[model samples]
Target: MSRAQIAPPAPSGPARSVPPPPSRPLPPPPVVGPSTRLVDLAAPEQPLSPHDPRSVGEYTLTGRLGSGGMGTVYLGHRAGTHGVVAIKVLAPHLLDDVDARTRFLREGQTLQKVTGDYTARVHGVGFDGSMPYIVMERLDGPSLHAFVAASGAVTDGEMLTRTAIALARALAALHADGITHRDLKPGNVLLTSAGPKVVDFGIARVVGQTHHTPAGNMVGTPGYMAPEQVTGNGALPATDVWAWACCVVFAARGDHLFDGDNILDIARRILDGPGAEAFGAVHRLSPRLVPVLRRATAQDASDRPRDGAALLRLLDRSGATSAVGHAGWDRLVGGGVR
Candidate 1:
């Protein structure tokens, strides 16, 4: 498959309604190359190496933002404009891996289709020669994981509720269109001035589908993968719901109930299925929210909230919604709420 990127058309209507699932047997996305320009960036913690390309298409590389398991993201600027964007280039190791390339391309395509207030926006996706990349809006904020690491775990109840609610709504948006963010975790949840914007859909697919991956290869982080994910049975929006509970708990305790141990052991424990009873230790904060999480992380996917829409209703009944204004949100990013 020729490496490609797709820029979803600008949103023309409300983003909450359901849409048809993306056509399968993937097609190449249109090549979208923005213009070039220079943007001064303070040196990143990890600067671009001599080997890194100075630009991809018309966007000039400014600095290295960061990298993930599958790609290196660079800060770039479009020509003749003051716009800054995040360029996510495919990791060199996976350049020849067809599955990895497919997943990367699918991620860009998924972002184009799944859009809402909490969904991360994609500018375009394309290949700079053989290198596939996705250009996305530059969200200037720390990830939920980074913020919790810098500060301690979230101790405030309202703030925790706000975080939980924001993530639930984001997931609901994806589930509305039958998309599942198979890799829902703290690192993928960017805490921006606009609240939480869900990013990285590298492993996302339609609910109840798993054939996208090579058999026996699990598609999610060990700690957050649902039971079916471990067995490679199938994926459901509930699979994301299970991971959602894990992220919320990470914010509250800065740890996972089934945390630590090796990946194999963690997967085994998750398969063993620990429910709400295991979360008794952290009940002090968000006592009501804990029960909701208990159900969200249920061992059986059927026992979970079903989808984001249903999950939102569960949160509402639990009073998880809160008036966590700017001040409360600021605390998560160290007074950096924009």
Candidate 2:
């Protein structure tokens, strides 16, 4: 689930295992073992605490997925239907914060319209009594942040390429719909069985919306924030591209390229942009990807690729030039980028 206290969590943890919710309960899939590429498998959901509700709207709360500063996500089951879902409810304290409440609901509404191979599906959004809540299809896997931290960098070249492309498309789709996922980082990319699905729109905005955060306050994870974000100018689609490039590098190298002692230090480096060493790292692992990231991480947003489609085209060209040929690209993209 997208979040607070959630950090792209709410049923998110490489360590935690969850059984298929009543929803989409296929026969048990093969157990994920040490040899498996994924970090998680069919496992038990965390038990709910006493304070957790027994039910929300039409869904019965079954277990705890996770919690964040804004709210807790519960594994929910509805009567008369086999569908199981993750339910995110606004914290009681936020009820009086009109801005937070409005934004929370807006996230739900916008998310409902955004669905494809690239994103988690939104099922419902409503007020269960006084509480505002969002219901989403439960995803079974770890975030890219957890995956890279636990397993190491995405060393498989083809998988890495596909990951870079899928994630780029996810953001592209968001921007196409006027939704900007302001917080695009490894933590928000879920490494699911189907491939990577980008999640968490907590800080996202529809086009032309005012500043999501108060003036002078930071909004995204520091290492991944774009220069525009650091300068407090405004977040653009290029801003997401900046974060995406950093994440791609992280996937290749198993670490963040920017290092700093504190928030201010990190912010300073972000504004300074990547150095020669960063490009060198990509050059060692994926020479073709270097230029794509080089442009994406440009200090000036104008210098970056225009949009996701533009990025996709760049990726296609990069893939074409790489050892992986056109037919290979087709298989990697599950027939096509659709």
True-structure RMSD, every candidate: 11.7, 5.9
Encode model 1's per-residue lDDT on 107-218: one tens digit a residue: 7888888758787689999998888999988775556775565555766777777888889999999988779887777767777767788877766786444544555566
Report how far off residue 213 is in candidate 1 (Å).
2.0
Relative to the true structure, how large is the alpha-carbon lDDT of every model? Answer: 0.70, 0.71
In candidate 1 the C-alpha lDDT for residue 196 amounts to 85
**Quick one: best lDDT, which candidate?**
2
Q: Candidate 2's residue-wise lDDT over 1-338, tens digit each?
A: 12231132113322223323344334454343345445243233666666678898989998877665567778888888887898888867888888788778887887887855677788889888889999998876667776666566665566666678778888778878787777777777876666678877777878765644655455677778788877777777888888889888888887776758776788798777787788665677567788899889889999998677788788778762354545443342332111
Residue 279 local lDDT, model 1: 58
User: What shift in Å separates residue 190 of candidate 1 from its native position after superposition?
Assistant: 1.3
Q: Which stretches of candidate 1 lie over 4 Å from their true place?
A: 1-45, 207-211, 275-277, 322-338
At residue 114, candidate 1 shows an lDDT of 77
